[model samples]
Target: MEYIQTVLFQVPASRLEQASETGGLLAELDGHRAYLKQQPGFRDLRLTRSINNEGNVLIVVETRWADDESLVRYETAEPNVAGIIRKHEDLLVRDSLQVLDMEALRTEASFARLESAEAARSRLVLPLIVPLGVLAFALLAIYGLSRIYLELDKGSAVGLATGVAIGILLIAVYVANNPRMPAWQVGGIFVVVIAALAGGTIWALVQEDEGEATGEPTASASPGASPAGSPAAGGGELALTLGDNFFELAGQKSPTLSVAAGKEATVSLTNTGIAPHNMHVADAGGQYPEAFCNPGGATPCSDPNLIKAGGTATIKINLGAGTYDFRCDFHPLEMTGTLEVQ
Candidate 1:
């Protein structure tokens, strides 16, 4: 089903001197540019501006939906970006009064910017051979020691010593590899990751054998279904579904489109495309359609929760024929097309 995400991004209006544009302010706008969705659930979203306008600083969006169930799922489902929204919410002049609806596309850069493990590696442009080699070596040391300890079947002391050894080895490897970084900080993260992975493996080995003898497997109770969330059997609160992009309309930016002025329309945002994409609409009340003022997570377009990745959303509207900008937040510069509200 198609769903609509009617987002209202509210920015603040302050004096130019005190409210000068800075990293913090720009970051808030940037967050809006790429904030598609997160893991937990939808939290509050607020953007601040020191020098923006008053009433028009709001962004009104109408995300299309495929059906009622899809829309319901998105509103109640979890979102992963709550912390990011909170972290940057205070930096800008948060009017929470005005709304700014800006459309963001699931640009290649947008997904790349997410800093996923693969993305981080690609952006760094380093000789990965060395790092990979070091990682392999570290794994060997930890595993070898861990195996030895297990065979001996010693008490926690051996486990503790192995942990400490892994910690020191990780530090040595990091320092020898990237001395430029702070010795202490890098060492700490390196040791934690190595210890966790290695330690977890050892524990799992023991547990699996034990489970086999008991004749009761616990993998069925894995956290795969809900992601520690509620049941996915119900419709989506904020979910990613098929047919989100380029499905019915090949070469189209999004599968779902919004007809303006409150038309009872359904926009199914199926994410056929590999990258994530979100829709935004700005109401042009007989103007050039340049002003966008709105706040995120203030009220519901239909229900309040947001649409999820690869998920469909809906937007209902009845707009008179005029000009409106329906676009995505990812491709802010060129990923925009004209919407004539008939």
Candidate 2:
């Protein structure tokens, strides 16, 4: 095996000029090189200097040999390789002389061969693998977010999609950088963070809705002044009000409209707020059941009437004895109520 010897010494700045004038250091280095070159199996020698932050200069000598036998012969006392070293002892820092021996574990040829093989695999496999990975991540994010979109509003849906995308990216980065991490732990982190983002977003939206509904009256409370649990006159007109975040009936916030079965009723939606809104009435949970209505109207809804402040849209519905849900489709996230058919 090839052997290497490294020698390190610190030379004081005070002696640099004196040593240079006398050519003492250079002559000593030349003598050592000549001796080592003539030795059997000697390969090469290198000398270098480095300056540290403290302005101190470090001298280094590296000698290479073809085999361990040559290195051993130079270190042993029989050859007396200490003559030049003794001459330089006074110029070196106390205890600064250090000698190290190293055996080569790998050669330049071995490194070159390994690097070539790696490069070949990377060129062939990386193009296919990278695109496939990106496609897989995209599909996973879409599938995961879609499962929760129905329960969220438009803003919440977008937020959820963004959160899921970020989470997926983080998982990819984590897995790529930390291959030793347990698979279950990686999945657990992703699930926990994603769920937290979804739940927190939903809760914040609900709180905002409630706060807006309670903070001020955006519409005329008189239109929504109808009492809760009061049965509407059978087939009669029921007054309603649409505001920024409320579906008001008879001047009350979210008043439940009770109407008799097998009758027709008209819900007059008066927009008394800055934002425009329309009323959409469907079965209890927004299931548009096959409830027959007036011609040209599939669901019980008004055209998205851009009712200006104080404008109104009258929606007539054929009421049946069943529970139904009513909401302003334009602001469905916060404007909604229940319709009870007795």
Candidate 3:
């Protein structure tokens, strides 16, 4: 009747293997400490044995909520006190909770050193480190070349190329030292190299797109303009994308989520599988009824529809006081989970 509370005791990735054994560190430490005894709004919590785990076996528990927004915070906030939020969310097994507490009075940096250090180290290693090493060798070679060859002018073509190479190496070192440097931007270097090969393709695409948008013939299209895909959403919105055979959680998926006794919230479905996939929702009870579907199902039923690869779908349903099932009809055992509505 009150706040929905969830407790999860997770292990740092490094100690994962050690935490899986019985009475391991995960059970004794992370799991046990979730409770600051006598803490307000404390409810039932549990510690369980890890199963089918290739990683640490964490202790997980949950409770119910009266306010939808509170549920959101309860799900996200406090758990972040340590790194538990980031560590557990991906590997955690779904443990739904229904709160029975009431009168809940709720109130409301940066150790990015790893990132900076990585940038520092990567600079030292990848660009700076590598180029400096190369430059040292190149400088030695230049000296040797000067000693052995006839024309040893520093302004020669070889000398110019050597200077350019050294300059690029120095810039790489600078980038390695700068955390703001985007290593990926170096990919543009290849774009320049391929410019000749891809010039026509790029130009044709631009002209064709412009022609389509302006309803004109491609042969006589204007100089430069093209209809391009809209830029992606930046903040608080998730854009599911496919790479190879999987999906990436691009941005915030559920920006505004709602839950109530009779109100339904939509589930955003994406197929990240190699094969075509679909999504379906059912009650925690064995109702076997499906809800929300893609280009497949019409309504709630026993079998959910199949969504194709790189596809997406949606579902909305009202839930009352009980636990509900949320799962991919195909990857049932692995992709299945519960949606608790107290």
Candidate 4:
């Protein structure tokens, strides 16, 4: 939810030397707007003036904030805001300044315009209920898929399941924001994700069949073996697999790697996942506190090389006999593994 603030002040005509002063005030206000715009979470700032029959001019300033925390930070520490207040203190009529803080509950135009209270209530309630319902259903789907798929590790399975849940929750929020959106369209988001998952599974199976027919080795089937279609592993070549927020070695997700002491190991990474990823190697024991390439005790971690969706990177490093950990900088918990130096 976003936060909004409105400030209104009345300036007497006597305070102005001429009509040109209004323009000068506005110009100064523009400088203030520019300063606020550079601040984080500053969405919009608007300044307008209204004249009453008594010839007193009312200046209204409306501001939109990304969240209350951003608003609070600005209010507490922003010298620019304070400057504006101080600059205007003499220009405004005595006791004319008013500030109001508010939270945006519902943003739909129809919700704001509805003549009936019950109708607006229904609109507000449905969005909250729909997302919760969709989340529950997504959890059930995840449970069913976990039961049917035997090879998925608990962590990987839960990650995938919760992803669907998050998608459903997002869809719910979208539909709620669009009160008039068609029901069928709202339902299609879930169907599309489910269909995509099924299609991906079938495609993976087909790829496995093709590999078998062509006599190429598969990663999952050959733990500790070199990656398929990779460079020769004569001296220091090893393979790392990247999937949707997960890492794999030889073909197994989060599998450990063994390297000889006082030697160099080149790691070739292939990303089959649908997102960009990168890997960083770090010493596990904190004694080294650096990235290891081969069998070295302490070494600087190789710079992270970006692997776009369906991309690969090969990096070589040297480490002494010690324990190390390699993980995706983007997803440490779901994509991490150990390296054993013998």
lDDT, model 2, position 46:
84
Which residue pairs collide in model 2, if any? 223-251, 224-250, 224-251, 224-252, 225-250, 225-251, 226-250
lDDT of each structure? Answer: 0.42, 0.67, 0.43, 0.64
Of the candidates shown, which would achieve the greatest TM-score relative to the real structure?
2
Query: Candidates 2 and 4: which is better by TM-score?
Result: 2
| Counted clashes in each candidate structure | 91, 7, 11, 10
Candidate 4, residue 146: the lDDT equals 43
Candidate 3 Cα RMSD (Å): 42.3
TM-score of each: 0.27, 0.32, 0.23, 0.31
Tell me how candidate 2 scores on lDDT. 0.67
lDDT of 1 by residue, 1-342 (tens): 123345444444432323235655344445543443341233334333322345324433343344445445654544322333344455334644232223345544557666586767776756676688688967766775555343332235367677768977976896789768876786677577667666756764664455344322222222232232222222322222222332232234433332434443333333333333444555664232323212242111221122223223443334454566555443444445444444
Per-residue lDDT tens digits for candidate 4, residues 49-85, read 8787768788877888888998878777755443465
Off by over 4 Å in 3: 1-258, 289-304
In model 4, the Cα lDDT at residue 311 comes to: 51
Q: For model 1, what is the error of residue 239's alpha carbon versus the real structure, in angstroms, after optimal superposition?
A: 16
Cα distance off (Å), candidate 3, residue 175:
72
Predicted structure with the largest lDDT when compared to the true one: 2
